[model samples]
Target chain A: MIEHYLSLSVLLFCLGVLGVISRRNVFVVFMSIELMLNAANLGFVAVARLHQSMDGHVLALMVMAVAAAEAALALAVVILLHKHKGNLDTNIFSLLKG
Target chain B: MFDVMVILPLAATGAGAILIMLVAAFETFRREGISILGMGLFAFAFFIQLTVDNSGDIYPFAEVFNGMLVANTFTKVAGLIILACGFFSALAAQTYFTQNKGFVLEFYCMLLFAAFGMLLLTMVAELITLFIALEIMSLAVYTLVGYDRHSVVRAEAVLKYLMLGAFAGAFYVMGAVLVYAGTGSTSFAAIGAVVADSGYLSNPALVGGSFLILFAFLFKAAAFPFHAWVIDVYDGAPLPVTAFMATAVKTSIFAVLANFLLINPEVHQGWVTFLFYLSILTMFAGNLIAIGQQNLKRMLAASGIVHTGYLLIALVALGSERFSGGAILFYLAAYGVATLGLFVALSYLSGQDERRVSFDDFRGLAKVRPYSAACIAIFLLSMAGIPPTAGFMGKFYIIAGAFQAGHAVLAVLGIVSSILSLWYYLRLIIVMYFREPEQRFEVAELTLAPLGTIVLAVCVFAISFYPVVL
Candidate 1:
């Protein structure tokens, strides 16, 4: 059971990384990052269960709070980018090179 | 009482941040008043931190809050550096906003918030505390970077930094979870105990977890392979914001890295070989990027990468034998002074929305404004690691530490990289003195950044002779 959960966690993390790398849309990239955090949350909970302690559960809660904060800022940035360039694609905002 | 004494500075900074935010809501604070208040708050914190004598009784609150925050001489000095950087950056921001519009009272609030986070970052001794503090600092910095919402450059910079920074943050959480899975505790002391008893390499989860955590740190520190984001992000932020990010952010990060690595000799030894190559590549790659840059801000940002490389050398030299925290802190102070000096000078000289930012823009500045030009030259030379300057002593201590650790090759490459860096540093000086003036060098006569520049230039010298008992 532990191995299965850990495998699922790793798979989700890799998918998040893939989404971040492949997607050019700003919102999608942020969602991917959120996915990555959730994957870590999964790992934290599973590890907590495996160890029979509540520390991982507490850590997962903290990570979720931080993720929410990051999501708020990311969405604000996405809105700002849209207002500036009239698009949500990351490639459209490339004024700074090198 | 000891706990309160240890946390007094942190409390003061937090209060100052909240006070400034509340004050920003009023109609009277205005731009100049808020900047001055910010400077005052930082100065207040610096003094508070300085007066709390922690040198003699090492670790006053060693087990406070479940061993999450430790206060030794190392964290004290790191906190001092961060506060001083904040004060000086606030000084520069005053002059920066004098000519450039888009000033808001909340800008100072964010500055204090970031400093508060960095203060926490330096003192964090637990994985969970480290994550929260890192987020606090990152979130504040992201807001500062994108503060100028209309600029496309700022937007791009914030997006890139936000994405990469969040990625790194997530990596840290994952690594923390893995290590928790392996060790059953999140505290540094507990983890060290575990690593010492079982050995660092015995557990697959711990090894993989530490690797990921180190990767996250290196990304934050702007080390090699994770360094490409630094130039653009630094260039994209406002001048004072960049200075704050350059000095305070890096100092806090290095402090945490040192603390993390100092947990156990076995753990550090396990990673020394990998860090050895990473330091070398960071230096050379930084030099290559810095050499090719035409924009002055981009070049400074790239040189910051080179400085990180040198700091990495000090980290490599730091074994479990003797604490090399003093060397790292001294180097950070020296680098902070010179880098902040250069940026403060640029803040006033860049003139009217920073139109003149490239290397060619400052041709023959020496002819028109001798004093300002000389100050910039001193900063550049100091950054180039010339004699009788703080940068020279910083490099000396780091290289000596490397040699003492028996990493002779890293020491030699460090010297080589310093020599390579001299070209760009001197190139700026040569352009200022040797070329013909392209435009009229304008200055805001009643500004504080120039005053800040002069003070930092003096610091570049005064900090050199600061005795480091390594």
Candidate 2:
């Protein structure tokens, strides 16, 4: 039973990673990161159930709070990028080539 | 009371950040006032950190905080470096704002906040606390990176940093969850106990989780594979912000990485082979990138990656029976001083709107401003690991530690990397001294940055004499 939930969590994480890599839209990429974070939250909840402790549950909450903070910052960055370049695509903002 | 004493510096920095935020709202305090306030707060925190008695590892308020934070000589020294970096970066920012266009009142507040996060990052002993501290530092740094929202370059830098940073944060959370699943606890002590009782490789979840955690750390430290973001990001950031990120952020990340790896001898053992190769790749990659760069800031950013590689060598040699992190701390201090010195000098010398950023722009700087050029030469030579400087001693200690740990190959490679690094370091010196003057290299005012540069140049020599017990 635990393995099934763990498998689901890993699948969601992989999907999030795929979204981040394949998607070019900044908003879509950020949503993909949020997806990855929520996947981790799912893993934490499942692992807490397996361990029969509240530690995982509390950590999951903390991860959610941090994710929220990151999302807020990400949105602000998106708006900043949009204001500067007048678009939301990642490819357009290639001023500094890495 | 003892716990409060142990955490006094942390409290000071956090309170200082809030104080700055509130003070920024007032009408009387302008840019100069807030700059002084920021510098004062960092100095205050540095003194507090210096006064804290750190004889051994003390878990402050262990019962109440559940062993989430640990304080020892290692964290103490790292905290001191972070605060000092903040102090000098604030100095650089003051001068940087004088000629540069985008001067925000909240700049110092963000610096204080970032320092506070770094202080917390160094001391965290649990995964969740570490994650929160990491985010706090990252978020503040993101704001500092793009606070001047008008610039397209700043926007691009912040976008790259935030996206990658959030991705790494997710990896860290997942790793923490897996580790908690395997060990049934989040504390380092508990995890180490479990690893000790049952061999590290016997637990699949623990191995996988630790690998992921290491991945996130390497990304933050700007090691080989994840180093692509650093040059662009550092180039786009404001001079002082770049200085802060290069020195302070790297210091805190390495501190936490060392702490995490030292959870158990077995854990360190499992990762040693991997870190060895990664360190080697990071050095050469950094050198190659740095050799090809014409922009001074980009070159410094690549050299920062090479320094990270050297610290990784120290990390690989860590966890020996007599390990005390003396080498790592000493090397960080040396690197921080030189890097901060260069950036501070650049802050004033880059001129209005940072027009004089390329190597060609600085042709024959020594002819015009001999003192500034000499100071920059000292910093560059120190970074290149020349004799009679802190960088030399720092490289000596790390390589010596590697040799003592029986990793003679790593030691030799470190020497070779330093040799390769000199190629770029010397290019700057040649540009400064050997060429004919093209421009006056004038400054509007004498300012605090040049004074800070001299202090740091003196410190580059002064810090070498401080003994490392390794």
Candidate 3:
């Protein structure tokens, strides 16, 4: 059962990474990052079960809080970019190429 | 008394931030007071940290926090650097907004929050704790980067930074999960024991997990390959913020890196070779990038990459057997003072919307305001590692430590890179003195910035002789 869950978690993480790199829309990219984090949370829970401890559950909760914080900040940046250029395209925002 | 004293600085800043937020609700509180208040609170906390920090005391409260936070001498020292950076940055921001328009009280609040996060980062002893602290710091910084909502350039910088930062952050969480799976524990002490006993290379899960975490740190520290983002973000942010990020943020990150490396010799040994080549490449690439830049802020940003390279060398040469955090801390202190001073200087002189840009803009600056030019020259010289300045002493300690650890080739390469850096560093000085005045150099009230610059110039020398403070 633990191995089954862990395999699914790995698949979800790979998909998240793929979505972030292949997508151009800022919203999609951010959502992809959240997906990646959730996948890690799933892995944590699986491992916690294998180890027969509550550590994984605690870690998942902690990661959820952090993911929410990241989402709030990402939304603020999205709004700021929209206000500046009326678009949410990542490629369009390259004014400083450092 | 000891517990109360140790936690006082953190409590004060937290309370001050809340008070400022409440004040921002009023119609006429004015942002200037918030800046002053922030600076005062930081300075007060810094002094309190100085007096209260007693190494290895392990306040009961800190332990009760479940080993997540460890307020030792090292953490206290990093906190002092962060708070002082905050205090001086507020000084620069105060002078800056007199010309520019974004004077919201929330800006100062964010700065305080970032400092709070940095303090936590330096003290974090658990992986989950470190990740949370890191997010707090990065989130506040992203907001500060785009505070100028009107500038498309600023908005773009924030977007790229946020996207990449979030991406790296996910990598960090994944890394932590893998490590937890491998070791059945998340604390540094447990991980260290496992790595030490089992050998770092043999633990596939921990090994792979560490690489991911290290990649994220390198990206944050602006090391080679992951370094391309730094220039644009620094360019888009206001001058004062650029300075704050360069000094305070880097210092905090390096502090955390040094701690992680100190965990076990075998663990670090596994990564040393990659770190060695990476440091050399980082230095040369940074110099190449910096040489091609004409804009002063972009040039400074590129130089920051080179400085990170030198710090990486310090990491490479770090003795795995010992837990000496001295070299890292001293170098960070020196870098913070000089870099913060330069940005503070730019904040005052860049004048209303930052009309200055190219190297030629500063030509013949000595003729107009010799003191400002001299202060800037001192900062540049310090950065180039000239004698009797903080930058020089910083380079000396790192190089000396590297040589002692039998990494002679890296030390020599480090010196060579330091020499290469002089080209860009001295270019500003030559422009300031050699060329005839091309543009009329303007000055403002000369209040906080000039004061900050002069003080940092003296600090360049004082930090070289840090034993005095010790």
Candidate 4:
């Protein structure tokens, strides 16, 4: 059961990584970032169960909170990008080539 | 009680930031008053930090917050450098805004807030605390980067910085989760104890987690593989603000990196080889990039990357056997003071709207404004690691530490890289003194910034003799 959960979490993480690297849309990229974060959240839950401790549970919750804060900021940035370039494509925001 | 002295500046800065926020809400008080108040608070913090002993790490805030934060010798020293950076940058900014005229009362508020976050970063001993402090610093900085919303370049820079920064933050949380899974705790003390007992390397989870965390830090510090964003962002930000980020932000990020690395040898050993190669690549890449840059701010930004490489060498050479990473701290001091001084000088000489930003623009600067040109020359030489200056001493200690720590090849590469760095460092000096004046460069009548520059130039040597300052 634990192995299944861990495997599922790993799969989700890989998918998120793939999405971030392969997708061109800024919204998709941000959503991929969120997917990666939640995948890690899943790992935290699985590891917590395996270790039989409350530490992972609290950590998972803490991550969700941080993720929420990050999403808030990311959305604001997306809006800013939309205003400047009139598109949400990651490649369009290449004014800073570094 | 003396231990508490080290963190007083941090406390004062935080309180000062809150006060500025309140002051910003009122229409009666002005930006000038807030700027002065902020500088005064930071100056007081600097003195407090300067007077503290440098022999050991003080745990003043250790118990107050359940040891989540430390006020050790390393931290106290780093905090002082950062506070001083803030104070001087404020001085430069005050004169800068006089000409540019986009005076927002909350600029001081955000500056103080960022300083507060940097101070907290200096002593953060827990992963969660480090994350929170890092965000506080980065968040405030993002606002400052976009402080001039009128400029499209500035806006673009902030967008780039924010996206990259938030992405790094996400990695930090993921790493923290993995480390927590392995160690049952996230505090540095717990991690250190576990690493000491079971050895940190054997634990794959801890190793992977630390890599993720360190990568995020490298991105923040703008190290070798992760350093691309620096040139553009530094180029776009307002001149005074570029100086602040170059000095204060780098100082704090490095302080925490040293702290994390010093906690356990097992952890340091686990990644020594990787760190060794990364340092070398960072140094060479930085030198190569800086050599090609024509714009003065972009050159300084690239040089900042080279400085990060040197700091990495120090990090690779640092050991957990000793309580203090003295070489790293000293080098940071020397580097911080010189960089801040140069930027302050630029803040004055860059003129309104920064009409002069390239190396050629400074042609015959020595003939036009010899004093400012000479001041800039001093900073450039110090950065080039010329002898008798603090930069020379800093490189000396770090290279010696690298050798002592058994990284002989790294030390040799460090020397070679320093020599390469001189190519660009000297380019500006030659432009200033060797050529005849092209632009009749009118220097700013900014009493505060010029004085700030001279003070920092003196500090390039004064900070070298730790006993005198401490």
Candidate 5:
């Protein structure tokens, strides 16, 4: 059961990584990052069960809180980006090429 | 009592941030007053940090917080550097806003919040605490970068930084979970104990987990493979904000990196080979990029990357040394003084809305404003590692430390990279002194940034004399 859970977590994490790298839309990229973080949350839960401790659960919750704050900021940035460039594509926001 | 003293600087910065927030809500407190308040708060924190006296073995508030945070001499000095960076950047911002039009009262509020997060970062000894501190600093800085939302460049810079920053944060959480799986604990002490009990390289989970963590740190610190975001982000941010990011943010990140690396000699030894190659690549890569840059801010940002490489060399040496992070901290102080001095000068000289941002824009500045040009020349020379300046001394110590650790190749490469860096740093100096004065350099009379620049220029030389522990 632990192996199954860990495998699923890894699968989700890989998918998220692919999405962040392959996708062009800014929204998709952010969603991909969220997917990656939640995948980590799943790993923490599974690991907590393996360790027979609640530390992983607590950390997962803290990560969720931080992820939420990050989502709020990401949305604000999206709106700001749209106001300037009128597009959601990350490639379009290329005034600073570094 | 020691706990209170240990927590005083963090408390002061946090309280100051809140105080600024509350005061900003009222219409009576003006903009200049708020900048002064922020400076005062940073000064207050600096003094408290100075007097705390962490030279002894007293962990101060170690047990009170369950060792989640520790304040040693290393942390105290890093704290002082962060606070001083805050103070001077606030001074720069005061003058920056006076000439430029975007005057939001809450800018100081955010600056203090960033400082608050950095102060916490310096003391955190636990993984969760480090994550929280990292986010607090990143979030505040993201906001500060895009504060002037009307510009397309600023918007673009913030987006790039935010996306990459959040991605890095997720990587950190994933690594933390893996490490927890390996050791069943998230504390540094617990991990170090585990590494000691069953060596760092022996455990697969610990090995993978630490690599991921180092990747996140290197990304944040703008090291070799992860440094592409720095030039654009630093170029897009406002002058004073860039100054703050260049100095305070780097200091806090290096402090945390040193803290984590110092966990165990075994841990350091495990990654020395990878770190060695990365440091050398980072130095040459940075110099190559900086040499091609035409913009002054971008050049400084690229040089900032080279400085990160030098700091990496210090980290590779950190394993063999027992001076306990003293060398890294000394190099950080020296680098900070010169970088901050250059930015403070840029804040005032960059003119209204920062129109003069390129090397060509600063042609023959010495002919019109001799003092400002000389200050800039001193900063540029210091950055290029010329003698009798702090940059030279900082590079000297890092090379010496690396050589003492038997990493002679790394030390020689560092010197070569600094020599490459000289081409760009000197290019700006020559551009200022040699060319004919075309554009009239008009600076505001009541600005505080010039005063701040002069102080930092003095600090560039003054900091070199302060002897390092080893």
Candidate 6:
């Protein structure tokens, strides 16, 4: 059962990586990052069950809180981006390219 | 009681940050007053950190805090360097806002907050605590980067940093989870015990988890392959913020990384081969990028990558019996002073809206602002590892440590990269001295950055005399 959950978590993490790489939309990339964090949370919870300890559960909660903080910051950045360029595409924000 | 003393500096910085935030909200103080406050807070923190007698690894409130924070000579020096970087950056920002527009009241608050996070980062002994500290620093820096919403360039820079930073954060979290799964503990000491009980390579989960965690660290440190965003971000960030990020942030990250690696000799051995190759690639790649840059900021950003490569060499040499962490700490301090000095000098000389950012912009600077030009030259020479400067002594210690650790090839390659770095560092000096002045390097009246630059210039030479055993 733990292996099954771990496999699901890995699958979700892989999907998130794929989304970050393939998607061009800024929002999608951020969502993909959130998905990655969730995958880690899933892994933590499953691993906690396997180890029969509460450490992983606590780690998951901590990760969730960090994820929320990142989300709040990401949303503000998205709004900042929207205000500047009037678009949500990552490719559009290339003024800083070397 | 000793533990409380060890933790006092961290507490002071955090409290100072909150105080600044509250003060900023009231809108009572103007920019100059707040800048002075920020600098004062950093100086206070630096003194507090210096007073702490961290002779050995002292895990503060170990039983009560579950050994989440540790202080030692290494962390103490690193914290001192971080606070000093903050102080100089605040000084630079004071001069910067006098010339340029977009002075926010909350700027000092974010600076304090970032320093607070970096202080926490250096002390973190647990993966979860490390992650939180990393975010706290990252979020504050992100705010500092994008504070000027009116500038489209800043917006673009912030977006790139944000997206990539969040992605890296996710990698770190997943990595922590995997490490937790493998070792069943998040504490460094516990993980070291597990690696000691069972060989590091034999455990597949530990290997993979460490790799992912290292990925996050390397990304933050702007090592090779993960260094693409730094040039752009540093180029776009305000000068003082760039200085802070370049010095304080790197100091903390390397401190934590050294701590993480020192958890066990086996772990360090496991990563040594990887770090060796990465350091080589990072140096040459940075040289290649820096050689083509017309703008001074972009060039400095690239050189930062090269400096990272040098620090990575120090990392590769770490964990040997004879070679202590003094070399790494010394190099960080030397590099921090020189780099921060350059940025502080640039803050004033950049003129209105940063019109003088390119190498060509500084033609004959020695003729007009000879003191400033000389200070910048000192910084550049120090960075290039010229003899009698801190950077030279730092390079000497690191390379000697590398050779002493039986990694002579890395040491030689580091020397070669240092030589290559001169191609760019000297170009600025030549431009500043040889050519005729195009425009007067008029700086704003009563600015402190010039004074900061001179102090750092003296430090570049002074720090060399502080010997580090290899």
Flag regions of model 3 displaced more than 4 Å: B1-4, B57-63, B320-323, B468-470
RMSD of candidates 1 onward, in order = 1.3, 0.9, 1.9, 2.7, 1.4, 0.9
lDDT of 5 at B423: 96
Candidate 5, residues B39-75: lDDT per residue as tens digits?
8988998999899877743444466645778778889
Better of 2 and 3 by TM-score: 2
In Å, residue A90's CA in model 1 sits off its true spot by: 1.6
Model 5, residue B361: distance off in Å is: 0.9
- Candidate 4 ranges beyond 4 A from true positions: A1-6, A45-62, B1-7, B50-66, B320-324, B467-470
Q: TM-score for the first chain of model 3?
A: 0.96
Better of 1 and 6 by DockQ: 1
Cα displacement (Å) at residue B169, model 1: 0.6
Return the TM-score for candidate 3, rounded to 2 decimals: 0.96
CAPRI category for model 5: high
Indicate which candidate wins on DockQ.
Answer: 1
Question: lDDT per residue, candidate 2, B1-470, as tens digits?
Answer: 88899889999999999998999999999999999999999999999999999879899859997888999999999999999999999999999999998888999999999999999999999988898899899999999999997888888999999999888888888788788878999998899888889977889988888888888998999999999999999999999999999999999999998987887887788789999999999999999999999999999999999999999999998988675688899999999999999999999999999989999999999999999999999999999999999999999999988998999999999999999999999999998889999899888685899999999999999999999998
Clashing pairs in 6: none
Those runs of model 1 whose alpha carbons end farther than 4 Å from true positions after fitting are B56-64, B320-323
Error of 6 at A95 (Å): 1.1
Overall lDDT per candidate, in order of appearance: 0.90, 0.93, 0.84, 0.81, 0.88, 0.92
Off by over 4 Å in 2: none
Tell me the TM-score of each prediction against the true structure. Answer: 0.98, 0.99, 0.96, 0.93, 0.98, 0.99
Decoy 2 TM-score against native: 0.99
Q: State how far residue B282 of model 5 sits from its true place (Å).
A: 0.5
Local accuracy of candidate 1 as per-residue lDDT tens digits, A1-98:
98888788878998999999999999999999999999999999999999898878889999999999999999999988888898998777778888
**Cα lDDT of model 3 by residue, A1-98, tens digit:** 97788788878989999999999999999999999999999999989988887767888998899899889988988888888788988888767765
Over B24-111, each residue of candidate 3 has an lDDT whose tens digit, in order, gives 8888777667777878888987887788756883633454655566667877888899999999999999898888876678888888
State candidate 6's TM-score: 0.99
